[model samples]
Target chain A: MQREHEPNEHAHHGPDKPTYNLVFVALTVLMLLSVGTAYIELPDILHYGILLTLMSVKVGLVVAYYMHLKYDNPLFTWVFILPVLMGLAVVLSLQGLAGY
Target chain B: MNAAHTSVHGAEHGHGHSISNEQHNHMLKFGWWLYIASEVMIFSSLIAVFMLAKRLYPAEEEHLVLPLVAFNTFLLLTSSWMVVRGLVSIQRGDQVGLQRALMITVILGSIFLGIQIYEYNEFTHHGVTLTSSMYGSAFYIMTGFHGFHVFIGVLWALWAFFKALNGHYTAENNIGIELFGLYWHFVDVVWVVLFTLIYVM
Candidate 1:
């Protein structure tokens, strides 16, 4: 298999054209959904759970599409994702300590 | 255009070949990752402190001032949209459009900072100070730090806007723009977390 070029990284071609506009629209819709969800009077656990889930989805979409993590290689994944995982670990620990 | 150097550190080398180039980018990438890690630690600490303060001052929870922050959130969200639109403009090689979008982003950012300052004055008038109470301390520190980031982002966007006017970036060589996009998106992400934690919660 031919190696991916690095100099003009953005000018890359794939089996199908990247649908950035579509991805952006979807992101906007997700944001709106989160906002609407925030206004709902759900139980506290379910409320926070839904918000966190939506946020996780939003972050995934932004990373994969806006940041092009989806198109990149595994090396790129490790480079960026390790810190995020560590951050999540820290957040979880903090939440645990806070008794939340 | 410069010749594509065959060195391991040039720009095209990837894994399994020249360990030098691979290692070089990896070092920068690792450093950036560490920077983000350190940032996570710092913010987490601040958030921990905020939580402690909130627990100690549950009475202030009823007095939680959120409308201004909600408006501030709108400003930030609008600015994020503008910055993303500017990136799309750059990708399309629309210099005029890029300049316009970046200008809107900068203006919105400035407006955000302005409202934040105004809110600070309002807080002071209402006897809220850095040492006033736990609520005041946490509220100011967390929101103040975020406002500072917005200020820096505004400056960064302004610089990029001027560069675009000077024909500095092309669709083919717009890594600077993308880097700015990363910073902008990061700021937006931070605000998203803050809005949920500090305001909505």
Candidate 2:
């Protein structure tokens, strides 16, 4: 029983389950790194830097893989990313203006 | 969704007289992502507010239960993965698999909420009310809003699970779960940032 669909019913297929497993492992490891480094004595700049970097990587993985943006329409990337950048810009500008 | 059938013309989008199912699904996806995009603004604003408040308040250090919150984070991350698993199941036309995965996700999410409520109780006992200080107020507002989203996610997941139970989706027409998956994943992504800013940093 083949289900009937118009041509091009599915434009793309996302990562398979194994890829998801790999991503899960990577995310978990990244999180552990973030947690482990939180307790270490380090310069304020470097400590915050490391944590922010790790957090960014984790967010990228979740958005790209788990959310299937990598396989979805490119327009989706733009739609989702543009606002994120705007939000970042606002935060940065506020920080600069506030002198904190 | 392996059943064979003839093509019927037209779409519910109302832009044109007819449209393939694929077009309809794409429209749905576009609409949903647009909504998610709007949500990012509100959430990012909340994050910014908290970060700024943290700097201004300069309050005495309050020790939160790191281990407990960390465990809660693990639950949320795992539930996010579970949501994807359910989507994969539906894509493969395994309705039962999707149902079970959604159930697991729901349970994990519920547990996360329970732990958050319990932590709030503990904090309240320690005199950390919303009016305590800017730091406490920002913390409660930001995290409470996220908890509200998680609660909504749980409810949506349950609705999706029931939809699957009714065989409303098929291998080739599972935009329903797929869309839900995207929302759930976005929720998880928000938590990822929240964990870093609110807890770790």
Per-prediction RMSD in angstroms?
A: 6.0, 5.4
lDDT per residue as tens, model 1, B59-136: 655544566666676676666666666666666676887789789889989998998898788778777778989878
Candidate 1: deviation at residue A40, Å? 4.4
Q: Could you give candidate 2's per-residue lDDT for residues B17-96 as a string of tens digits?
A: 44567677778889999999998999888888778877887452365677788888888889888877777777777789
Off by over 4 Å in 2: A1-12, B1-16, B58-61
Model 2 gets an lDDT of 0.82
RMSD of 2: 5.4
Q: Is the docking of candidate 2 incorrect, acceptable, medium or high quality?
A: acceptable
Q: What DockQ does model 1 achieve? A: 0.24
Residue-level lDDT for B121 in candidate 2 = 88
Tell me what fraction of the real C-alpha contacts between chains A and B each candidate also makes.
Answer: 0.11, 0.60
- The TM-scores of all predictions, comma-separated, are 0.75, 0.89
Q: What is the TM-score of chain A in candidate 2?
A: 0.82
